[model samples]
Target: MFGMRKWNTPVLRPTAPFIIGGIAVFYLVAKAQDAMINSEEYKNDPRNPAIASGKKAH
Candidate 1:
């Protein structure tokens, strides 16, 4: 049925791109954390002078 009606289809094109970009950003962050865990920096925990000298009351 060909009925002449003006219907506005809200633009949904940007939704997918936005979601994809967000996922990419979070993925990169996780990858960075993985790299850190593999690095020596993460493996070695630097001693804190303050905590070593005196224990602060919690």
Candidate 2:
């Protein structure tokens, strides 16, 4: 059969892995960004306020 499966068979679609992986990557990125934002280095960086105020940092 060309890409045909019996009604009783269970199939794992290809998008399942990609969907899970995308969620994992999103979670990790959010955690990293939170850490970076909370770090002293970020707080002391003048560019942070400047960016927030919509001013170009020199």
Best by lDDT: 2
| Model 2 misplaced stretches (Cα beyond 4 Å) | 1-12, 49-58
Q: Which regions of candidate 1 are displaced past 4 Å?
A: 1-12, 46-58
Per-residue lDDT, model 2, residue 56, is 47
Model 2 C-alpha lDDT per residue in residues 1-58, reported as the tens digit of each score? 7676566554457578988999999999999886675577775576575457765434
**True lDDT of residue 18, candidate 2:** 84
Clashing pairs in 1: none
What value of lDDT does candidate 1 attain over all alpha carbons? 0.63
Candidate topping TM-score? 2
The C-alpha TM-scores of every prediction are 0.52, 0.55
Minimum summed lDDT over a 10-residue window in model 1 is located at 49-58
- Where does the lowest 10-residue lDDT sum fall in candidate 2? 49-58
